[model samples]
Target: MLQYFTLPVTAFQQNCSLVWCDETLLAAVIDPGGDLPAILAQAERRQLKLEQIWLTHAHIDHAGGAGELARTRALPIVGPHPGDQFWIDGLPQQSAMFGFPPAEAFTPTRWLDDGDTVQIGNETLSVRHCPGHTPGHVVFHAPQIERAFVGDVLFAGSIGRTDFPQGNHQQLIDSITQRLWPMGDGTVFIPGHGPESSFGRERKSNPYVGGT
Candidate 1:
């Protein structure tokens, strides 16, 4: 079975997740923004063997620690699509601008697309290229667990900001309605920040994209 724990990391309180397959004790860390020590400690406490680093996008608050973590553990980096390469390349400047710890950029072992599937141990997750938040943004959906790790796409009562470079409000709305809605209303989503919420709830109450 696939199980996960959400850990708030960095000053941004980015919700980094540690997802593992119970049967094999193998795991993957999603969006390790910073504070690598705490992340590694949690995985060790759970007795999970860290296998991969999966990113939803290359924003500073979501991907700051990926390079260091992957280099230290010799784990492969995956996802976020190819469109976020520019953001990845700007990690150093982003870190300085945000007052975050020094960050390094690294190449992903695999650049995910709309239909790619990622695996950890015996479990698999379907990847959806949900852009607008970032052109390369992707969401990891675990059908078996009815969970979607959506980064900076949709929130409990709002949607991602479309003011950044290449950000488009219409594109973000389309990603939410077209790519995310099909995942099922009952599915619980972990946003990049703040509390988790079900798609059904957001659909009925979210001011930005509700009533669809």
Candidate 2:
């Protein structure tokens, strides 16, 4: 079975998830935005053998800590699609802009695309290329558990803002309606920020992208 714990990090309070395959104890940290020491400490306390660092997008709050953690743990960094390269490249500026600590730009060890599958011990998570929040944003779905780590794409009561450079409102909507919704309404999702919610609940009541 796959198990996870969400750690809210940085001034943005981004949700950084520590996911593991309980059988093997192999773990992957998702959206490691900041507070590297705390994240490492928690993993240590839990006795998790951290293996990979995964990013949902390149926003400073979601990807700021990735480079440092990868360097410290010698783990591979993956995902957020190829389109978010610009955002990743601009990490330093984003950090300065948002009053975060200095951030370093990095290239993913492997770039993911829609339909790609990543493995965490015995569990496999499907990737969905969900743009709008950021062109390269992608959601990680654990089908067996009916759960998703949906970056800033879809939230409990609102959708990701399309006001940033390269953002497109319609694309965000399509990603949610056409890609995310079909995953099954009962699916529970972990957003980049705020509390987690079910796709069913969001689809029925989310003010931004809810209802038939």
Candidate 3:
């Protein structure tokens, strides 16, 4: 079975996820936002080697620690299709714009495609390009654990904001309907911030998104 830990980091408190499997001992770090210490602490506690750092989008709060963490762990850093490459590449500028400490530029080792799979333990994480929160936001769906580490694209009772650069309101709505809601109602969505909720709950209650 897959085991998981949540590390809520950065000023905005993005929930970075550390998911691993007992048998294979393989692990993947999702959105290592900030506070490298906590992410490392969980890595040490679980003794699961981080194979890769996967990003759902390019927002600084959800990607701040990615460069440092990957360098520290010697893990490959992968992002969502590079549509947010500008944001990812301009992290320092983004930090400055958001009134934070200057950070170094981060270039991911790999740019994940829509149908790509990043194996973790025995299962495969299905990548679905669900932009709108940012132009490259995506969600990693792991059926074995019935969990999805969605970035700003999803939340408990609300959806992600579409006011930033490359953010599109209509596109975000379409992504939710076409890419996410179709994942079935049972999928447990672990968003960038706040408590976890299922696709069913969000479909039923999210004000910004309407259910079919």
Q: Which of the numbered candidates is closest to the native, going by highest TM-score? A: 1
lDDT of 1 by residue, 1-212 (tens): 99999999999999999999999999999999999999999999999999999999999999999999999899999988999999999999999999999999999999999999999999999999999989999999999999999999999899998899889899999999999999999999999999999999999999998887
Which residue pairs come into collision in candidate 1? none
Q: What overall lDDT goes with each candidate model? A: 0.96, 0.93, 0.84
- Please give, for residues 93-182, the per-residue lDDT of candidate 2 as tens digits: 999999999998998999999999999999999999999888999999998999999999988898999999999999999999988999
How well does candidate 1 match the true structure in TM-score terms?
A: 0.99
Please give the TM-score that candidate 2 achieves against the real structure.
0.98
TM-scores of all models?
A: 0.99, 0.98, 0.95
Tell me the lDDT of candidate 3: 0.84
Q: Which scores higher on lDDT, 1 or 3?
A: 1
Off by over 4 Å in 1: none
* lDDT measured at residue 200 in model 3 versus the true structure, 0 to 100: 88
Q: How many clashing residue pairs are found in candidate 3? A: 0
lDDT (10s digit) by residue, model 3, range 1-212: 87788878888888999988788888888988788888888898888878888999878888877888777778888887789988888899888888756665777898987888887778677999988988888889887778888888888888889998889989888888888887889989899999999988888888888564
